[model samples]
Every structure is written in structure tokens, then in C-alpha cells.
Target: MRGWWQDLTDLVLPAECAGCGTPRTVLCPRCRAALAGGVPRRVRPVPEPPGLPAVYAAAAYADEVRAAVLAHKERGLISLAAPLGAALAGAVRAGLRGTAAGPPGTAGAPGGHGGGPAGGGRAPVLLVPVPSARQAVRARGHDPTRRIALAAAAGLRRGGVAARVLAVLRQRRGVSDQSGLGSRQRRENLTGALTTAPHGAALLRAGPVVLVDDLMTTGTSLAEAARAVTSAVYAARVREEMEAYRTGRSRKEGNPVYRASEMRRAYGAGHVICAAVVAASPDSVVENQELTKNVHRCR
Candidate 1:
């Protein structure tokens, strides 16, 4: 297979830094620092898309970080997934920490910044990829976002977060290349383009969901993916509530009443807990005096 050949080629070829072409290393120490040295922070795209999840990035997409991502994704430097995954894991942690910064009323939304039950028994966080189009994957010979997401999940589990990659979102239709599109145009192009897979609803309910991506520009893709996920969550909740109503009547003729917060807690508001990315655009860096200022802003 192509992947096997690529792996073999990496073993046989002379090593060089993917970002700067430095000899004798896949990524030089300087480049590694450029890629992940910065703290993860919340980022918002200009003209943010509807349903866009709160997102965090390990580094800004510039200089060596941008080059490294392009090398791994476009130039087939597959070995870089490890470091990129580590970067993404940092972003995931920032977003998970953001849960603790939830505004005043969202206390029971699950996975708070605490270490115990307020965090939903420390349930495993589901990292869902914003899928690449099938055509794009065929042209590129691999799914870049999903590859990095797998690595991120591994890194997260190692760090004791109980994480797993969930490739549940799928493109439901064709889309034009995003290269020439502006933010609003990108949003229009991606509207209703992604949907959850069969039985994905049940899987999504397993734990807190975190949208994962290699890079974010206008955030259209993450927004669409979030819409699809939350829609499924809403439908699943309705079904559960209906079933509960029927069962409650049969058992005690109205012995139990479910609070709205109970429902919101069940699905985390169908809003993704947040999104994690390897890198973000520089303009999105919210420079605040208080480090936690941007943390609760996403809600």
C-alpha cells in the first residue's frame, strides 16, 4: 500500500527537517520549539460561522509551524504526526480546561476544570475529526486531519485524559475548493455538507465531544461538523425523553420528572465541549491581561 511504501521510504531516505530542510533530522529542535513552544489559547475566526465550537490551538500557523503542517499533510512527511499530535494534545487540554471556565449557569455541563465527579466522572473525551472530502483524500493519498487526531488521542490518553478519536463526521455532498473563498463564502459552501454516520448518535453520547482539526481558517468546517453532531444529539435526546415518559407512566404513573439541566448535562448542550487544533491564525490570539479571560468567552 502507499502508506507502507511511504513508511519504508522514510526509513531508507536521508533525514532532513521538514520545516527548514536542515540536514540530519525530520524536525530540528528550533522548529519543534516554533511549532509547540507557545501556550494553547482560544481563537475565533473572522466572521465566525454559525455553530462554531470554542477552539484552542497549540501554536499560531506561521513560520515553521505552518511549514511543518504543510510538509506532513501535502509533502507526505508522515513522521511528523507525533509532534503535531503532541501540539494538538496541548490544545485539547486547553479546551478541556476551558470547560471549567464555563459561564455562571453552565456548571453541570460536564467535564469542568476540576479533577472529580463535577467533571462527569472524568469520562473519556471524544475527539471528532472534521472530515476531509473523499475527493480531497484521494488526491492527497491520505486523510491529514484524521491522522493527526489519532496521534492526539494517543498523547491525551498517555497524559491521563482518557481520550479517543471518533471519525464520525462525513461529508454528505460535494464542495468547491476553499482556496479562493472568503469567510462568508466558505460558510455558504459548507452549509449542510457534513452529517453524522449511522449509529453515530449513540457513540456521540458516550462522553464529551471535542472537534479536532489540523488547522482552522474561517472555521466553516468545524461549524458544520458541530451542527451535524448537535442535531444528532438533539434527536437522540428527544427519543430518550419520549421513552422515559412512557416508562415512567407504566412504572408509577408519573413518579419521575426530568429537569432541563438533566437533559443538557446528558448531551453537553449538543454544543461540542470545544475544538482543538495543532495551529491557529495569528489574528485570533486574544491578548488579555487575565489568562482565563478567553476561556469562558466561547459560550
Candidate 2:
């Protein structure tokens, strides 16, 4: 029934592959394989931005993968979201597996905040999509990253890993276009531009977050997004500590929690298990370390 419907739909619509223009298919198998030919691996931008979470990418942004991304993002080929999302799901799984050896507070580790014991008490992985500018979304007529994140989350759930998309990040202000900006200029443009949505703190504390984006160039956006999330978590922890102190319910043994810096240090800002993007530039992968080692060491 499903195949017949697809055949009928293709016949009427005259569909073609988004990547290679193959007849009668939304995406051909060859292009789909190109999107994730190798296992996802850690990728880092040169002159890595401070506070940037470790990122995993399924494929380098080149050839067919690059064509597919551009088609979906710029050409309004919305049907490409599914295949792109499946590629993202592969990257997400790679991020999860990479963190399996991470300490507590990280996702996918035994007894970790996101991956708890085997008895169904695990915290669901939260997929936090980086926000695009309001103007950009309006111009494109869709939120591409958020849509892909949602599809990736659905794929993760189907694969037996609890996951959900959390659209909590928002732009606090506008900035100029990033098309012509260099790395440092891009960082300057995005600094302090993002913030969490109202009630984001409570939601953040419920599980470990993995930043999601469709692409990564200079890594400026991801770094800024991480800073915003960390700032929110820091503020929330401070508020909780202050309330506990005032109510005589403080958990400290002797020294009172008076110093803001101390509290910040104790809670350690925010924790992003890692990041995942559908594709990234080949030059962005760090050159100084082995591939597997880099994947494990980035926390």
C-alpha cells in the first residue's frame, strides 16, 4: 500500500532526486550513501571557539552532501529534510557513543545524567537546535535547522534512544549577515546574541542537551549558543542556592554559599553532552589528533 502510494505520488508529481536529479525518487541511494559514507566523527573549527561543545558530523560538506544541503536550505526542497535528518541521526548516535566513556553529567555514559541505569530511569536526550535570525527564517520561509532536529529526534526514538527536540534558544538581538565574515568577525557578530526561552532552565535541568545545527562553518554560532545555555543554567543554579540559604534548607555543611563565582564553579556552568551537525567542512576537523582519539577526548 505504501509503495503503491509512493509510486502514484511520484507519477503525478514527476519527482527527481534532490542531489543527483535521478528520476522518480526524492533522493537516490547513491546520494543518500554519500551523506554518511563513513562513521560520524568529531570535527572542530580552526582556532576553536571557547565554550564550544564537541561536535560530530556524519559527512564532510562536499560533493553530493554539499549539493543536498544547499538544495534543502536554499532551494526550498522541503522533502530533502527526511534524508538529511537521517544523516543527522547518524551523527547524533555517533555523539552519543563518543560520550559513552565520559564522566557523570555527560550523556550516554553509565549512570550519567542523560543515560541512567538500565531500569527506565534515564533522562531523555534533548536536541537543542541553534536559532537562526528572525529575518533569515522569514526570508527562507522555514526554520531548516529546527525541522531537521525534529526529524533527527524522531529517528533517535525509533532506534530505541529516548530523545526529543527542545526549541528553547532564541535570538536576543539581530546581527548582520554572516556570508562574508571571517572567523573572528563572525564571533564578534554573534557574541551575546542568543538566550534561552522562558522556562528553559527547568527544562534544561531535566536532561542532557546536545546542540544541533544543519551546518558548521566557523563554529561561531555553536559557541555562542553554548554560552547562552550555560549562562541560563548558571543563573538558575544561583537562584536555587539563594532560595535554599534563605529558607534554612541549605545543603552545605559549614561555609555558606555566598560567592557567585564559587557557585558557578560548583555547578560548572551548563553541560552539553556534545553537538551534531549533518555536515561540516573538511578543513574543520582537527589535524593534531587521531580520529578515534579525538572523538573520545572531546568533552
Candidate 3:
């Protein structure tokens, strides 16, 4: 248990490493290296849930990694967000590697954030955080995932990736605590539980989007998030077509052919619909090995 002074001190100046309790550092060198050492890898839960976007994780959810995540999330050690966000940024870059970003010298291309030589007219990548439950956010006094996403976006920008955080997903209903829930139960509990804000679809159109979270256990949350995003984008397309038809626009203006092409352009290739996380369950990493091999083979 922690006292008020401890909490205050933790918020201001952490005295011990969040991952290994090494003295006099928010995160000691050993644990920091552990968190960010490995190359980010593709991960998938066994019996992969439908609509789950491709996910990349910086490390397995074990040992020091798990402790660090818990310290930052449950204990509200805000300073840890920087290291965690750096790890997440690595995963995001790995996930986006080789992904289509439109032709060079066009919008959404690499370095598209500014007209400056570094920016090259490329649009910033959008980082959509999985929304936490309202009650949970109130209890924690901060949205951990969103904070991490913001940190990750900052890191990405500093690295010339041109990223921005977009907190556009929301929970549409209440859910029982996911603790102790199996994969199937978690999936059932989260189905249709999330939706995008009215303006979320338009915001997502700014560039390729990457769903981000602090940790992934069963991947139920990310699947739901992906579903909500795709649904909202599809709904927006429908509305555009309906409005065009109502206005008596010609086939060139509102035809299915044109809409399909527009959707492809907006979403790019399958790479546009992917996710990244700081860590994933060890089981997921192991279970996904064969799939990862196949993915690499194709690439």
C-alpha cells in the first residue's frame, strides 16, 4: 500500500525504478533496455478474433515489462509514459514498414507533414487510442492509453514519422470488468461496445491510422476498435452516396464504382488498418510465430 506522500513524490520525482525497483531512477538502465531491446514483432492471439487488425508489439508481457506497464497504468506513474511510448513508437514503425503510403510526392507519402524539405508534403499518421471506460478513466484521474498515444505521437514526430494522436473512439455501453475473463468471454463482452465520434471518420481520412494501446492480453479490445473504425468509415461512404443521389447527381458523381475507388484511396492497402502496442501476452507472441513467418515470407 502507498501513502499520500509516496504518491505525491511518485508524481513529482520517482525514487525507484518502476520495472525493477532499482534506486534513484524512474526506470533504471537495465529495465529500460529490457523494455526497448528487441525488434518489434507481429503478434496474434490464438483463435484470432475476426476483424482484428495486424498488431505489432515491442515486447512480451512478462517479467519487467509487465511490472512497468502495471506501474504506469495502475499506479499512475506518469513519468514512465515516455519510455513506454518510445517502445510503442518502435512497434508502430515496424507495423507501418513497407505499408502503402500513396505514391511519392503525393499526400500521405513519407515526410508529408510540412512543405519543408523534411516534410515532403506527406500527411501525418493518425494514432487512434482505444478508449478506456468512462468509470475507469475517472478512477485513474487520467486516460493511460491516450497519454501513451500522445507520447508515442511525439516520439514519432521527433523521428520524422509525422504522427498525431486522435482520441476518436468511445465506449457506447458499459462492460463488466475483463479481469479473469477468457478470450471468448472477453470478445462477447466487448462486441459492438465501441463507436467513433461523429467527426472521427473525417479525421481518420487525414492519413493512415494506427490503433494503439498500452498492452494487449487477448486482443478483444483492438478487434472491437477496428470494427468500430471500419463501420464508421463505411457509414460515411454510404451517407455521401445517399446525399449525392438525393441531389440527383450523375453516375460520375455518386456511382458505386466511384465510391469503391474512393474508399480504396482513402484506406490505402490493408496496411492502413493495423494496430500497435507496447506489449503483448507471451502466449500471443508464441502462438503467432507461424503466422509471422508466413507474413514475412509473403513480404
Of candidates 2 and 1, the better by lDDT: 2
Worst 10 residues of 3 by lDDT: 290-299
What lDDT score goes with residue 67 in model 2? 81
Would you list the rank order by lDDT, best first? Answer: 3, 2, 1
Report the lDDT tens digits of candidate 1 across residue range 68-107.
Answer: 9998888767788889999998888878776653332232
What are the per-residue Cα lDDT tens digits for candidate 3 across 1-299? 34567657876787899888998889988788777777777888887888888888887777788889998888888889999999999888877763445434322345333223335456567899999999988887779999999999888878767778889999999999999999999999999999988788888767667899998889999999988887777667668777877887746654753566566445541124578999887777443454343223222
Which 10 successive residues of model 1 have the least lDDT summed?
290-299
Q: Which stretches of candidate 3 lie over 4 Å from their true place?
A: 1-8, 101-120, 257-266, 269-272, 286-299
RMSD of each: 5.5, 5.7, 5.2
Cα deviation of 243 in candidate 2 (Å)?
A: 0.9
Distance (Å) between predicted and true CA of 197, model 1?
A: 0.5
Clash statistics: count for each candidate: 0, 0, 3
lDDT of 2 by residue, 1-299 (tens): 12455534644574788767888877788778777656788899898888888898877777677888987777666677888898898888888777654334434665554333223555677889999898878877678899899989888877776778889999999898999999999999999999999999778876677899999888999999888887898778778878988897887764335565654444211457688999877668643354333233221
